[model samples]
Target: MRSRGCAEFSIPCPVDLRKYLSESEKCGICNLTSNYICRFSMKKNEPFEETLGKTAAQMSSQKENRNCLKGPLVLDFLFAVLPYSAAKKLFDKKFSIPVVSFTNLGVLDWRRLDFGNGKINDAYLATAVKHPPSFQVSVSTFGGRCALCSSLYATEKNRRVAERFLDGMIQELESAVSPSSHKAPAKSQNNAGGGSSAQRQPAGQQEGSDSKGERADARDKGKSKSKPKRKKTVHQK
Candidate 1:
């Protein structure tokens, strides 16, 4: 978001309420999700640790207070007591969906995903494609390796922006996990031929981790020297 001149933003994170509701068992026919909005404000050149701490605190507080359940409960009541059309209309009028969203699908079971025909090299969660100005990013882990996928309204311009944004995200993640002594220099965002392309790091090469995983690489020849102005809000849902 900082790359897009967004300093303040709110992102809604889907919360799984099954554990809270004592419905932990998997049920293919049921939906057990709710959401809590995470609001963030970034200071100029603020350390990433501060941002991460704030996000963790906010999410923890919301979950402890059971705030995520309110939306689903209200919707359930409205549909149960009112006519279908009336309920739908009322809900639509009262709620406004955010333009940007984020979700973490958690770790996928490799054993279950196996088809017994061949080994799966990689897997990631893809979000639904949305209209213009709306975007979503989803995260998943497979075999101790993290992956990120994003969906948005596509145009030549928008696609380029999204690719750059994802590339920035990957760089941030890699820096966070890498040792300070071996940290690489920041790369320029305006580099030619840059895109959100995954590059697999050798096993035990990244921070001494044993897992071999893919990371987005946006090759660059220079460094970014300027900070962008705060101009937009990133709404995540």
Candidate 2:
């Protein structure tokens, strides 16, 4: 949202309380989730860490106050005393849907989803389709790797924008985990020594060379019969 020029926005995050329930209170197949909306503002060129800390603090406060449980309690009281139509109307008038949302579905279990045939290489959870001007991003993990999926109502222009947004998000996450100092030397070496430097480069020393000659020496000594394999799967909304 900040990247799209929206300085302020609110996102509703679902809070599941099933794990907090007593064993006797654990009813089967029921919706035990509520949510709290967190409003945030992004200053120009703000550091990601500052934003992350603020978000964490807000969520912690909400959790400490048991805000998630209050939503359900309020709804139950409203529907209990008021007529169905009156309650519905009141709820609609009081709450407005947000334009942006995010959800994390946590890790997926491959064994449970298995069909007993081909292996489940990778999987990601996708959010429900949202109308124009509304967008949602969901994440899921499988095989120790995280996957992101997005959903939105799109025009040709909106589709292109969504693609670019997701791409930028991926790059941002990558940069957060892998620092620039770790990435720069490999790119510099590749540029300096031409195509031959790439094939003979070792995984650990890819970003370690100070000069072209050192890079050439590392490349020559680091040759292996088989290169490490990397698997990447991309899912577009």
Candidate 3:
């Protein structure tokens, strides 16, 4: 860009780069088009920290469902990528979006996502090296913990740098959710479903009685141990 006498500049809108494709798609109720992607620029800046803060706060507070970062970002990619990639054939110019993409799949229910064989161990995101974005970040929360996963396409010369960048992000997040700063969860909501102490009184009393029996059995064993063994004189015959 500096060689072109500009502080920042973009390459000749890579035209005909993706010419072997269609411009529209129809899937059930979704009718996707390529018109919007032709002039799209993925360089738009979104304050990640602010977005993360709001989402985290809501989740921690036990708020309702949040169709969060993953839904919008991934759905947009699903609807747009193909059409945009095919734009080179339809028009003379192909569009650009963020070189670096980020998506947060907030707190998923693994039990529901399971497919009977077993539960999902983990989930991840990735990108193509031939694609514009060289780096991407994907986040998800599960088992009361957060996973910050990243993907990067890099050559030997830049692989270390990419690793460092990703490591830095993970370290920062770990610091944010440090154990010392973490708060204990409030009383379980399960207790509200007629499972409170009053409702459990009978069970508790039975358990207390069981414990008393156990104590009595223990006392009997002690008494048996305390009794001196009867000595039998050996008969000469």
**Root-mean-square deviation (CA) per prediction:** 10.6, 11.1, 23.8
Top candidate when judged by lDDT against the true structure: 1
lDDT of 3 by residue, 76-158 (tens): 56557667656444333333444554445466665566687833433322322322234545555543334444433444435
How far is 107's C-alpha from truth in model 1 (Å)? 1.3
Q: Is candidate 1 or candidate 3 better by TM-score?
A: 1
Off by over 4 Å in 1: 1-8, 20-32, 179-237
Give Cα distance to truth, residue 62, candidate 1, Å: 2.1
| Model 2 bad stretches (over 4 Å) | 1-9, 20-32, 181-237
Rank order (by lDDT, best first): 1, 2, 3
Best by TM-score: 1
Residues 51-127 of candidate 2 have per-residue lDDT tens digits of 77777787777777776787678888999999999999999998566677777788777777779884554455667
TM-score of every model versus the real structure: 0.69, 0.67, 0.36
Worst 10 residues of 1 by lDDT: 227-236
**Ranking of predictions according to TM-score:** 1, 2, 3
For the record, the alpha-carbon RMSD of candidate 1 to the native fold, in angstroms, is 10.6
Q: How close is candidate 1 to the true structure, as a TM-score?
A: 0.69
Per-residue alpha-carbon lDDT of candidate 1 for residues 5-106, written as tens digits (9 for 90 to 100): 346767798777777754456565575777888887877666666777888888887777877777888999999999999999999999767777888888
